[model samples]
Target: MRCFEHPSQKRLLRFISPIACLISFMVTDLVTAEEAWLTRSQQLLNTLQGQAKPAWLENNPHQLEARQQVLELFNTSKPLTDLKFGTEQSPMGKNGQPLKMLFISFSLGETTLKGIFEEASGRDDVLLVFRGPKPSQKLPALMGDLKRLLKGIDPVPNIVIDPTRFQRWSVASVPDIVVEQDRKSRLHVRGVSSLSWLDEQIKAGKQGDLGTLGDVGEIAEIDLLEEIKRRMAAIDWKQKQQQAIARFWAQQKFEDLPTAQADRDRSVDLTITAPRDLSAPNGQRIIRAGQTVNPLDKMPFGLCLMVFDATVPAQVELIQHHSCQDKKARVLYLASSMPRQDGWDSLKRLETTLQAPVYLLTPDVRIRFQLQHVPAIVEQVGKHLVVHERKVRASQGAPS
Candidate 1:
């Protein structure tokens, strides 16, 4: 009031006041465009609204894929699809794995394994390799086999359970010796467990398969490499694929909600304070930091989101009859829960039953809508979201 009493100061204040208001309004509009939850939700839904993932991704988890690819490494018939082989360098295998290895299996027995381990001791380049896990591909079996074989041997040999090496050298028998340099086999001796014999043969300028100098004993156990290949060939990947997909879906973190009980209605405020300056698509400054925004003023909602638990038949039927289904606005179906037994199958079935594409409800959409129950319709009414939680138990026999 005292400052307004001065005429010159009043004129200056009048000059700056309009500019400040203009800046504040611009900032508010910018934030509204940037931080509006509805705008973000619509964009997300539009991208994934009706899109179904490929069969491989839907049914395959990383853990199972990892195990399968490793198994594929042992199959010599294929070109080694897994990434266990080195592609370059003279002596260095890719990812710093050893190039020279003694291909021995648990069939070598305790005494022969002890001898090989002692011979390979203090040798960095010569790594003891197993064509496959002992007894079976299970980790516990492999660990038990190692414990049984290397009980008394001091300084456990540098060991690697890489079946790729056996495939790389086309090893048909255990206790095979191989030295690779520059992606080419330099020396390979089948039916020999002695790393010392390999070194002596190399010293004598022996290259290629040179183990036939004298009689070599036959492997006692079934060729584990061949057995691994046979087992791999016998796998029912198609059946396991469905199980893998189910596991993947079961591991997902969905914001599970209870069945809608009573008829109710609610509102969601679209107001958001800008975290920073936001720009429009045309590169114009819209909202600046700290400005409160409501995006409905500029961008109206033209899409209706119908959320329900797909596992509930009554709720699904209610959604089918919801008024929004006949609205001019684009309707998106989002399921809170679906059958985890065969997620892809259930998704397909839901889409078939509704004659429309269905998607899984995301946590962000749930939080933004402030959803507490399923079988709900979310749409914009005027400037804020209006969630219509309809009661269908009386006629529709919705789940309690």
Candidate 2:
């Protein structure tokens, strides 16, 4: 009883202390000379709170100044009279102010919606309008955007209403955005955007000089067919075998050893066999159909098989055999040691960086390669192997 009562008393005291402190601080603060200046500043902001004041001006001075610097060209726009935006009313634009409101919507399951919202939150002037079919489930996304925007800056005033408020705002897909000029407002994006892009839009609206934003390497989206091709291209067992055959043929004194086509003109072809038991003691693993003959007892090509605990030979060959069997040119396999989702992210980074074809491999799907690191690069150059290992400074040559 004592412990329970003590906890209840502590909870009550904790809840009351902050309110008491706040009241005491408010009383003291209201009496000081500095408080008088703060009061005057607040009053000034209130006076500037005309219907057409820039969105940044709705906040305090610090926020206003930060927005002005970030927004570049500040314009004045009227506050939205009708908070609701959807099919019912026409979209509103500023008759003369700084930032514009953009209403956005999405179909569903758009991962990039948050990134665009995050970009918008950095500016005080721009108002982001979001509406959804299901208001309860959808409103959280908008609230989250607003909350993030309000952080680290004076809270920019925004009105959130249901989907039935304004008209003329359009959404292309799940998480689409519509830009509005609410009298004093400017334009905001209705699609995927970045912070720099948002800044550029603000500058563009103000007729200020703005430049393009650069990209970092990462795969944005993966095409299934292209991924298959990439994995196939990584195989070198056939290519290497062909090279060895060509070199042997060139050295032969007799021209009777099937002198048919030139090595350079002929392409390397290969067939990969699944796990098969070998007649030898080494116990076969995943082996190519035309592998080198074992020097010891004469039977057939030394059969290799992929095993669990026993030593698995030719892990690289196994990967090439399985993953790239049907793939063609312009193919890629993005492997990461971090994790599967992280591997996909690395794939995205590569897509962004290379701006080319690439695919991400799922984690836990253990490939035979000794990839115990991050940022490892593997590529097959015809019959030769090329690997670029990312280091602290720069990547070194392909792992020997």
Best by TM-score: 1
True-vs-predicted CA distance for residue 260, candidate 2, Å: 99
Once fitted onto the true fold, the runs of candidate 1 whose alpha carbons sit more than 4 angstroms away are 1-100, 105-109, 133-156, 190-200, 209-211, 221-265, 279-285, 307-328, 335-354, 360-364, 372-376, 389-400
lDDT for model 1 comes to 0.61
Q: Local distance difference test, per candidate?
A: 0.61, 0.32
Give the distance in Å from residue 17's predicted Cα in candidate 1 to where it truly belongs. 28
- Regions of candidate 2 where Cα sits further than 4 Å from its true position: 1-95, 105-113, 133-159, 162-166, 172-179, 182-190, 201-400
For each candidate in turn, the TM-score is 0.58, 0.22
lDDT per residue (tens digit) for residues 51-138 in model 2: 3333322344444444553232111112222322211233234454444444444422244544444454434455554432232333
- lDDT per residue, candidate 1, 1-400, as tens digits? 0011223223223423323334334323222322342233233334433444333343355435555655544442221112222211122344635367777766767777878877765555666766655453564455566666666555455665565566667776776777777677787777667667777777798887666443344434333456645765776555564455556578866658987778899998777777777765566667778888775665555568788988888889899877663366667787788777666667667777888777667665677678899889988887887898876675684334
Which one wins on lDDT? 1
